[model samples]
Target: MTTDILTVSCPSKRGIVATISSYLASQGCSISDSSQFDDVETGTFFMRVSFISEEGKPLSEIAEGFTRIGAEWNMNFEFHDSTTRMKVILMVSRFGHCLNDILYRWKIGMLPIDIVGVVSNHFNYQHLVLSHNLPFHHIKVTKDNKAEAEAELMAIIERTQAELIVLARYMQVLSDELCRRMPGRVINIHHSFLPGFKGAKPYHQAHKRGVKLIGATAHYVTAELDEGPIIDQETIAVTHAQSADDYVSIGRDVESRTLARAIHAHIHHRVFVNGDRTIVFPASPDSYAADRVG
Candidate 1:
């Protein structure tokens, strides 16, 4: 039984679900799990459907057949074979907690992504990235050579034909051009404190203010620094007793988990970019199944 997923987004209209369901059934596909949203304010409809092809129809056939429905609804749609893993490129700076966590998940088949390569501005994680038999690119970025560095980075992206770029604690701010070019294709993770805790040792500042909650945000990278459409977020309760160091430690765990969840939602096609926000659908029943228990 081959499983396939179909994602559709378009202007809201009547009979969209019925039409889609009918078409899938006409093709001998049985829907296993489905999610849809109708935005009343925006008048946009989003849907994701996971189905099993009882007749074992090829994806191309199913997609080609759906073109009629797509055309009728003026929908932007995609059909994905559930077994196909999305290719991803990871960018990281000196921080390795998120990088390390992603690597472990990828290694254990928990992430289910093909990590084409790792790009870093420093040599800190060169050895670790290589240990996994993955190519490591060291493209140092300086104020004077920022453009050149990004060019080199784009070259890698094109060469690998990577589908997504994950900035797992990458420190440098990407240029507006790069951000515009990638749009929702690039994801970044950072501490959730912004505006309140501006610069340098944010945890320490939070400690001084006696903040009760610490969290991380994973969002699609945009031109306006960290102000992109958020995909996932998590927070941990903190008390007055915990020190700044404890905040950092707990925040690291939150960041890693939040980033991983964001990546999972993205690779599985569960996220839809709405206006300034996002429409994230729930995961399928088997989405969390890893190949092995480690």
Candidate 2:
């Protein structure tokens, strides 16, 4: 059987899922997975469905036939075969926590992406990346040669055909040109939840501010620096008894997973951009569970 995945978004209306499911069933498609969300505030409907067909129909046929339903519902729709994987390049300066997290998940088949290479200004993690047989590029950036370095990075982005760039802890601010060029394709993991703690030493800032929570933010990279549309965020408890360094160490775990999950949703096409925020449809956690005690 041939399997195809579809994603759709449109104005809120009754029976959108019924319309889509009925059309697929009529076409001999059997749904294997599905997810949907309704935004009451915006009155928008979004859905993602995966199905299989016994006739081995070509993906093009599925896409083409779906267009009529798309027109009828006035919906924006996209269909793709499940075999495609998004191309991603990782960027880091010296920190390895987030980079290590992504690599581990990718190695275990939890994250779906093609890790083209790892780029860094420092050589700290080159051996670690190379040990996994992934390409590593070292491009040092300084005040005198920042522009040239950015050009070189852009060249690598173009050469590798990377659809998404992840700044795991790249430390350096990107050029406005690159930010504009990439738009919503770049994802950054901020050490803090953001808008609350906004500069360097965010953990320290949190400690100083005496906040009760320490959080992380994963968002699109815009020219505004940490001000782009938010894709995912998570927070953990902190208290007046803990120091700043403690927050940094404790926050590491959440930051990495938060960013990786954001990338996961993105590569799976389960994320949608909406205003300065995002819509993320998560896979069912229960379906992923295993190893029940016998």
**Which one is best on lDDT?**
1
Q: What are the per-residue Cα lDDT tens digits for candidate 2 across 1-294?
A: 544678898999999999999988877788888999898989888898878876677778878888888998899999866667678999999889999999988887777678999999999999999999999999999999999999999999899999999999999999888998998899999988857787778889889889998889999999987888888899999888999899999999999989987887777777887767788887643223211222
Q: Which 10 successive residues of model 1 have the least lDDT summed?
A: 285-294
Q: Write the per-residue lDDT of candidate 1 for residues 187-262, one digit (tens) a residue.
A: 9997764458755677788889999988888999999878899999988899999999999999899999999999
Candidate 1, residue 35: the lDDT equals 95
TM-scores for all predictions = 0.97, 0.89
Quality of model 2 by C-alpha lDDT: 0.85
lDDT: worst 10-residue window of model 2: 285-294
Indicate which candidate wins on TM-score.
1
Q: Note the Cα lDDT for every prediction shown.
A: 0.91, 0.85
Q: What is the lDDT of residue 199 in candidate 1?
A: 56
